[model samples]
Target chain A: MYRYDEFDHAFVSARVEQFKDQVERRLAGELTEEQFRPLRLMNGVYLQLHAYMLRVAIPYGTLSGRQMHKLAHIARRYDRGYGHFTTRQNIQYNWPALSDMPAVLDELASVEMHALQTSGNCIRNVTADHFAGAAADEAADPRPYAEILRQWSSMHPEFSYLPRKFKIAVTGADRDRAAIQVHDIGLHLKKNEAGELGFAVYIGGGQGRTPMVAKKIRDFLPIEDLLTYTTAIVRVYNLNGRRDNKYKARIKILVHETGTEEITRQVETEWQAIKDTDLKMPQQDVDAIDNYFRMPNLPQRPEGWSQLAAARKADASFARWVDQNVTPHKNPDYGVVTISLKPIGGIPGDATDAQMDLVADIAEKFSNDEIRVSHEQNLVLPHVAIADLRIVYDLLLTDGLATANAGLITDIIACPGLDYCALANARSIPVAQRISERFGKPERQADIGELKIKISGCINACGHHHVGHIGILGVEKKGEELYQISLGGSGDEICTIGDITGRGFSSEEIVDAVETIVDRYLLVRTDKEENFLATYRRLGAAPFKDALYNETANAA
Target chain B: MSVKVLTANRLTDGEAVWLGANGDWLDHIDGALVARHAEAVAALEEAGKAAIKSNLVIDVNVIDVEERGTNLYPLRLRERIRQLGPTIRLDLGKQAEKTSANAA
Candidate 1:
């Protein structure tokens, strides 16, 4: 948890006042919609179907209990009693009034949070692994680097007005939980044989109308040159990326049009010139940022091992939850607990104001005062003691947050589709709901095992359908919602764009189509141990495609 | 010809509203002014522009509707959702308010 220094406090307070003035001017009819839209968007406000939506950033998916409580307060006061946690680890309030935005921002600033780069053609909220510092296999904590990038890129004069919105993700672990491969810039923090910290830099990875796996431009860049190398890549894209078509404006499109080799060469040439500049991070500065993220003091809790074993033995439901939602932590006694936002047939990633408050309370009391919003649209208690798992689980169960299907079929990722988004051609939440209900059984979900079903309303791919193990993209065909299924897509270490199965399914047929794919994988998988992704990779898209289209063909 | 209705989100609160026959914005689309012919459609579009200029609304558009019995139903799903709120959450949006109002 990085506390806001006097500078950060002053800077955020100033921005809030500035936005407040701008809002007043707009409401007073001093600025037209065209003139005010970009300003509103810069403050993370967007006019949606029914009302304005506000996106609040959670830098590197990290939050303190106080900040979580503040988010709950915002939901209760300014919005409908809930907020949607997005795939990029940001929370969006769907029904905030335009008149309430200034006050909402002021409230956020009080909590050391701002919606600044959550939108617009600038470096957006830099995401990192949800389990960054606590994960067992991490090389080093990536948030320190992410924080450094946030400091450097926040209102960076040179990169603010790039061709399109840019996203960067960093992961310290080899597991790639942050989905670094699918971002504009993906930094893999690691140490070389000489024990010097550096990064494996990836460029031009994005998911939209065109999905691209980032090309690894540098084998290893010294940690000191993080900002310099980043500036070089962005500068190259900012200069050459197409501004003619909004669709072709992302760095991913530029990387596609210009060959990877040439783009890498251009970035390298630019880097060579700026390598010795002030952009190079000094060691003391890095250490200063790193100091903010030092691991929390955890005295040995030896009694927790025996207590956890006893608790697991007493309750099968608790055991199931622990098995599904808990992952190993750096400390043997501690575990990273994922609080499932996806209950049976519930909206994915939505938490009620009460739930948010409850989570905040639990985080403060049981876990360290830390909470994380995972990119999978779940919340994380990064340092919950194994001994305290039962108490936390019970509190969560009261609010229907203790679903034992973390990586299962029901743990879906869905975007706010035609339901709320003016840009959406079809509805995504309903499709996700139907699929979750269809496969809501715990035993069934366990049997299916680790299948990600991500849904997007349109090709904007906000739901990240391109990376779902079973991706369902909703598109309007002939005035009806048609869901296009893509199999074998994954946003992981070995990332690949999903293959489109065949003719899309109508809204009525989509759930059955997804079931058919799951059932087909179940039938064809080598064993229960083989997940849907492994089976899909093993036997390409043909079998699942047959199951989807052949069944439709027979029905027709 | 398909009937048309002028719709926009109110600038102050961003509540979805439809242009009424009395030259006023109505939160519910039931009382919206319908345009069945080219001339009326032109009038509706003009009103939308006027509303935008007046700074009363944003994202103004004239959407196609089908006259079903005595009611107007939007042709596009997006517009329908806008009128009725999100389909997924029946407890939310205009649909819930309408339900409660009718019940009352």
Candidate 2:
């Protein structure tokens, strides 16, 4: 909903012109492939296994109907008729030409979007809750602050060439759909006892080779010092971060090596100088950005929409949808509808161009023409009128986008593994497909309840396997694809790295192994309401680990 | 064969630079000559070498590179680095292109 102002438009246009020139040099033979790789990657372009992959940033996972349609168009025209929505809420095209990138970027800019900061060791896309302003538990909309941060960091004078890439996430709501804990810097907006706005900051959180939950560095930072404090934290890492070894270069490692207390001191020392400077939020600027994120004016509910409920009260299928797919809204009459891109047995986040267009049309007609990209790789219609639920559901149904399992077992997150990615050591998409097929039943998924299953091709954790309630990491053992499972990993405010359950499994048995773990939890757990995460936390991995590796139970 | 109007943005200065006729980058822009933008021209030359070796060269011919629009010196430098194998030391063979041409 944030329209690009003149300044924003000018800035993007300038970037486009510059890239177009670079492309020409590349084609003309002045720029060699080696010379241009980082330059291209900074714009979110990658030469994958078979084709050039271009990742376009869907910042904070929000999009308008027009932008969605444009993406659909790009998919049909340039790519293989679809785009894969990544675990980070970005859309990646697998078949873009090196020559066509500048053109693709120009089109994106027309929609007020670009691939800037999507990759290359810079502060990557600033992700946020899909239900930012509309969620019932939201303290305040985090997007205005996010947008301010975005502009400040875009082509920032310093900190661009850091040791490694950085990721930041913000969530205003009590429930963390943005997965704030796993980000490099996670900010949770909160109103203190005195009703003043502040942020609960988490640092040193990531899901790559080393997975760790962020340590809380600041309990509640005042609103005035948000950017200054964040800049300080980044600056401390930038100046002292390990550049000798690429693997240990992340700020997460720095925090881990030097402890959170020392890191906090360093950040505070850096902040003392810049706190009152231009980084401080100007009233007019904050107000201007905040205006774009303001809630839509909706009238009071036409009484008994909830009572209208389900025509067939016993229709458990419909009830399942209402329970899982729908989220409560700040406004009574409106509900945030999560359209699951993960139809059972379909690729985790790959949406067909037709499906994208259909969703765009639905957003424009039924919802408020606004769509959101959840970090879990699902689509959100944040302002759907409760009265038109059935109509929207029917439309979503035709497109195979109407799966009600939003947080349920079936909404798995998986990366484009060896199938597309050059960095992967083993296959991920196939393993995910295997799991999807195994747990294809909607009723089965609903019974298992809200379980987060994530798979990464390798340790990069693009699939966010580090945060999954049941995490699966695909690795290679003697040239054969194997999976290593981790239990109790979470991505909420209280984040935790999953403990490895035991030895790896062959690809053939991995999916079944995962299902066995879930089924065992279902049988032994106390009640139906207790989710996988809750059960795991109460008892730790003993029960689940024994159930899987103990030869007698394993045979069964 | 191309159908769309494309735009490119530079990551460093966030300024517009012309794609060189030689297939890499150019120091001249608008009415500004390479001599006028001396620092930028030199940086582009360095980047040109890096870009040439960044990935498998594509869309443009690898041979007859000057006509294809890429720098010859960087191509030679990339080969030298490959020979040395991950040793960050710069191969003196790299600067031979500029020196040889200047000497001639």
**What is the lDDT of every predicted structure here?**
0.93, 0.77
DockQ, 0 to 1 scale, candidate 2: 0.03
Residue range with the least summed lDDT across 10 consecutive positions in model 2 chain A: A303-312
DockQ score for model 1, please? 0.87
Residue-level lDDT tens digits of model 2 in B23-72:
44332221211222446555545544454355323322121111122222
- The DockQ scores of all candidates, in the order shown, are 0.87, 0.03
Q: Which ranges in model 2 have alpha carbons more than 4 Å from their true place?
A: A303-307, A310-316, A553-556, B1-104
- Backbone N/Cα/C clashes per model: 0, 40
Output the chain A TM-score of model 2.
0.97
Cα lDDT tens digits, model 1, A343-433, are 8889999999999999999999977899999999999999998888989999999999999999899999999999999889899998888
Candidate 2 residue B84 C-alpha distance from true site, Å: 34
Off-target runs (Cα >4 Å) in candidate 1 are A552-556
Evaluating just chain A, the predictions reach TM-scores of 0.99, 0.97
